[model samples]
Target: KINKGGQLSMKESGEKDKNECHGGDSRFMAMTLKRGRKKKALEYLLKKEESTVKAMVDLKKKYA
Candidate 1:
């Protein structure tokens, strides 16, 4: 943490800082996903939610 004067405490050192950003070794960061996927699943889910709400509003107007 920084002091009110925006200065770091002398006790704060790079040794602890190096440990925090460790995202693991390269093998752990490797991904099996294909590159440039366009998230069609999320788009589909959003469309589903929108249609459901529109449908509910129409039903409420017709039957309420």
Candidate 2:
């Protein structure tokens, strides 16, 4: 079954199996996904900053 987050969850046979659905696994998975996304964004920002600094240095050297 697809959950509201578009993640495929186990379609439990019991309607009262709410605990199984909202257990630690789903929470852990969400945290892991956030961590991966955060890491990627940080890497991208660092690379952009590095390129901007390099460009500034090159421009200063050209004008000097």
Candidate 3:
């Protein structure tokens, strides 16, 4: 945490700052996926979600 003067506290060292803009190691981007690869992954996820929703709808129709 920072003080009102916008400076880190004594217990908060500069190395503890986790902001990616400040050159922190981001675990989220650690995969190193390419742009096209990311697009394909997202499309696959969307298709899976769509199929799950469709199956749920069909199950509801069958029971309700």
Candidate 4:
């Protein structure tokens, strides 16, 4: 789904068996960003040393 800022968002649909639901067991979410933003995110993760599964999510939000 698209959010207020026109960015893609993953809202829970409570469909546990469907990958379309952001809350699927795979725990993977997809988004699109500019190249610079992607590089910045990588730098941020490295500098902060937060590469755990949860931290990667936080990084996504921060860069988004």
Model 1 lDDT tens row, 1-64: 4332232322345353321234311111121112222253234224434543353334334433
Which candidate comes out best when scored by TM-score? 4
The better-scoring model by TM-score among 1 and 3 is 3
Q: Tell me the deviation in Å of residue 39 in model 2.
A: 33
- Runs in model 1 lying further than 4 Å from the true structure: 1-48
Candidate 3 accuracy as lDDT? 0.35
Candidate 2 residue 20 C-alpha distance from true site, Å:
53
Sum up the clashes in candidate 3: 0
Ranking by lDDT: 2, 4, 3, 1
For model 1, the local distance difference test gives 0.30
Give per-residue lDDT, candidate 4, residue 13. Answer: 68
| Clash total of candidate 4 | 0
Worst 10 contiguous positions by lDDT, candidate 1: 24-33
Reference-based lDDT, each prediction? 0.30, 0.41, 0.35, 0.40
The per-residue C-alpha lDDT of model 1 at residue 14 equals 37
lDDT of 4 by residue, 7-39 (tens): 233344633334335432113322422344566
Alpha-carbon RMSD to native, per candidate: 19.3, 17.3, 16.3, 11.6
lDDT (10s digit) by residue, model 2, range 3-51: 4434344445635244235642234334434565545433433433454
